[model samples]
Target: MEYNPQSKQEPLDTESEDRFASEQPSEFQQPYQYQEMKQDFKHSGPGIASFVISMVTVLGYVIAFVVVGAMATSVFDQSGNLLASASEVIITIGISVLILSALNVIGVVVGIVGLALRNRRKVFGIIGTIINGVIVLLFMMLISTVFVNAGGL
Candidate 1:
């Protein structure tokens, strides 16, 4: 087409403008979709905290068990006599177990609260609750065994 310096460029035809506008997405639609996705992925802080606490408590329990087993093995001599420091080690392990058990209980409570909040992290809360329940059961079993072995049962 020849250039016409005297004439202003004509605006797009209405039909072409409408076609272009229709091809491109609406600004409002994009933000609504983005917001919906953000809401879907929203996290529950308490649920996450409960999960983390439960995991830590379970790990501590395992480490405590291993340490206690090692101490029990090492503290006895060939004559089967307990060493002077063996009781202290046992007492320390017992105290740690008690503390971890308490933490597990707290995790369970937090998980329940998280679930009750009906947040997006409910799965984590449920998992945390289940883990804490198992840990509590294990703790009770260990305590009962200790008592039975000590002739307190």
Candidate 2:
């Protein structure tokens, strides 16, 4: 019902020093099993490689698109007529797509390898796999579209 400063006395042994007296040691040392477990878990190297590859592929796509967009403007005359040299833009796009496609393929392969590592952490592996797989699928679709259009199908 009311606050009392000296209501009850705390145990003298629990006054910080005596409380930790038995718990304290001459030096800090971890348990053997704990130390072993601490060193057991690590990030998979291939997983990191896969993630980096995917990130680079994404950046490459962005840069390629931006560059192509900039150059494409020059391919169109102000009167909406296509220039005779528009083939260069096509060639640039083809090369960019091929390179990005290859990068995604590598990322997917590396991510799969990472996932196969028995003791390593799998978060990056799974994420990289998914990202790379999606990009590869998109590239496949793009290639298919090109083939279809070229064939007049």
For lDDT, the strongest prediction is 2
RMSD of each predicted structure: 10.0, 12.9
Candidate 2 per-residue C-alpha lDDT over 36-132 given as tens digits, one digit per residue, 9 for 90 to 100: 5534779899999999999999999999999999999999999998899899998998899898889899999999999999878888899899999
Give the Cα error of residue 77 in candidate 2, in Å.
1.5
Tens digits of lDDT, candidate 1, 1-153: 244343356766799669767866797665334334435865677788889999898789789888888878878889999998899788979899889989999998998888888537577888888999888888789878978899954
Which clashing pairs does model 2 show? none
The worst-scoring run of ten residues by lDDT in candidate 2 lies at: 1-10
Q: Model 1, which residues run further than 4 Å from truth?
A: 1-41, 144-153
Clashes of 2: 0
Model 2, position 147: C-alpha lDDT score:
95
Superposed model 2: Cα runs more than 4 Å off: 1-40
> Cα deviation of 35 in candidate 2 (Å)?
10
**Cα misplacement distance, residue 153 of candidate 2 (Å):** 6.1
